[model samples]
Target: DNFLGTLGGPGITVPVVGAAFEVGIELAAGGVEVNLVVDASSEFRTTSNVIANSPAGRDDRVVVVGAHLDSVAEGPGIQDNGSGSAAILEIAIQMANQQISPRNQVRFAWWGAEEAGLLGAQHYVDQLSPRDIKDIALNLNFDMIGSPNFVRFVYDGDGSDTPLAGPNGSKNIESVFLDYFAAMSLPVEPTAFDGRSDYGPFIEVGIPAGGLFTGAEGIKTPDEAALYGGTAGDQYDPCYHLACDTFDNISLQALDEMSDAVAHSVMTFAMTTSAVNGTDKGKGLGKFKSDMEYRGSHLVK
Candidate 1:
């Protein structure tokens, strides 16, 4: 072969006896122009989204629970998103183990390439027919659920705290978390629902959505520090998007509390027969635009 490059990853096995191609890297002076050729390794790669669905006992409405199962290139992204993915996967496994059924079909999606500009989640949404889109009653997304200096950040579904709001019935989802924390005597704060995570795709097409976030690169205000007992003026996640975001970077207390709320909200929507947006159990008229701005993973603060 004239130009050769090795190709192997995860489950694929490459023969050990193959010779590595000689790398040709050329360098030239900063101002002097010269022809340069480098044998940089390259290959086309592909990834797929993981989706599990449980059929509804009677109703056809669907409640989609989603989390991104990817990390940035710079780090392991443990607290950035591993926390969210872990919480939901455990919930899914336990639900199957217990053989629990819900009135509405529950779809759990571990999205691929979310850190790559929400590609997987957006592709899933883009492929849905209008009827299919309408069949989705609501979406619950969990991202960055446990930061080291975490705050209990529930999305402002009704826009009372923030300027942005979700589609109708999103307030109900927000209320679910608020009520849960209130019952436990925990202080809560509302985070702007600006479609920063996987939920961005769902809400863009008018699907009512809401979820929990502990915190990220955003600085922890003095009031938030007082409430959550973390350092004031420090970032909610000091290791966010960094190589230091290993399991050790997570706060066990934040994970425990946020995960409980995640389960509570999931179970609440699973059993409820009520329509999220006053539509006939997801068979709404059509899709519409959300008022919030859509944000890419890398672009988010």
Candidate 2:
């Protein structure tokens, strides 16, 4: 509240009302220090979602395993998505190699244009009929599974830890991952379904959804560092949305542990004989919290 400088200079301040309020505060004052840049360029484009299924026989309920395949232009997105993408694809391949037939139909999706606003996954859900939506037992989203300084995050599907929970059986889906991590003795925590990833579309239509995230732009607390072995006060992924988010940006330990959890949950639902639906099945529409908004650039909201 006590600084002003020339616009477009090395340190800009009080350039204008809107710019002043948005990015003029100093980092120490709990506001980000940033240089303002505006291209004002926009365009329309098309993209496709990539999907595949197991050759094995199908069951009545459908289990969707999804991860966004697109990345921001800054980096290759190896950890942000490559970890998740590779995790599911390997599971699909091994399912065929071992010829493991599940009790339900498993659909693997690598969604497109997620950075553009979760467009690909939303389109797929929007195209589904009522019956199609009902047939979907649940969804597993793995948006970012490997961060260099990471913490294992399972979606709080039942809202046990957050106000906005996922649809009906989301708790069951959450349980599957919890059990998997517990069995491995890995420290895990609940992450809210803030509608910032591909799962946003699935949960919006009453489809139970859950997944893992290794933290993005979220600072690691001292407690989390004590549990996960990382530098406290540092971001879980410091290179997020930047060119430095390359293969070296990933933690193989996080990838190994999280990927195992993903595989365990995916296979568990694939073969589960129990019904995941419940009374709340009819209440999923508009379940994503209305109070919070999705700010894609930071992804914390």
Candidate with maximal TM-score: 2
**Model 2, range 116-160, lDDT digits (tens) per residue?**
788899999999999999889889999888999999999998887
Query: What is candidate 1's lDDT per residue for 31-56, written digit by digit as tens?
Result: 54555455543445688999999854
lDDT of 1 at 81: 87
RMSD of each: 10.5, 10.1
Q: Kindly state the number of residue pairs that clash in model 1.
A: 0
Relative to the true structure, candidate 2 reaches a TM of: 0.81
- What's model 2's overall lDDT? 0.79
Candidate 2: segments with Cα more than 4 A from true spot:
1-40, 278-301
lDDT of 2 at 170: 84
lDDT for each of the candidates?
A: 0.79, 0.79
Cα error of candidate 2 at position 70, Å: 0.3
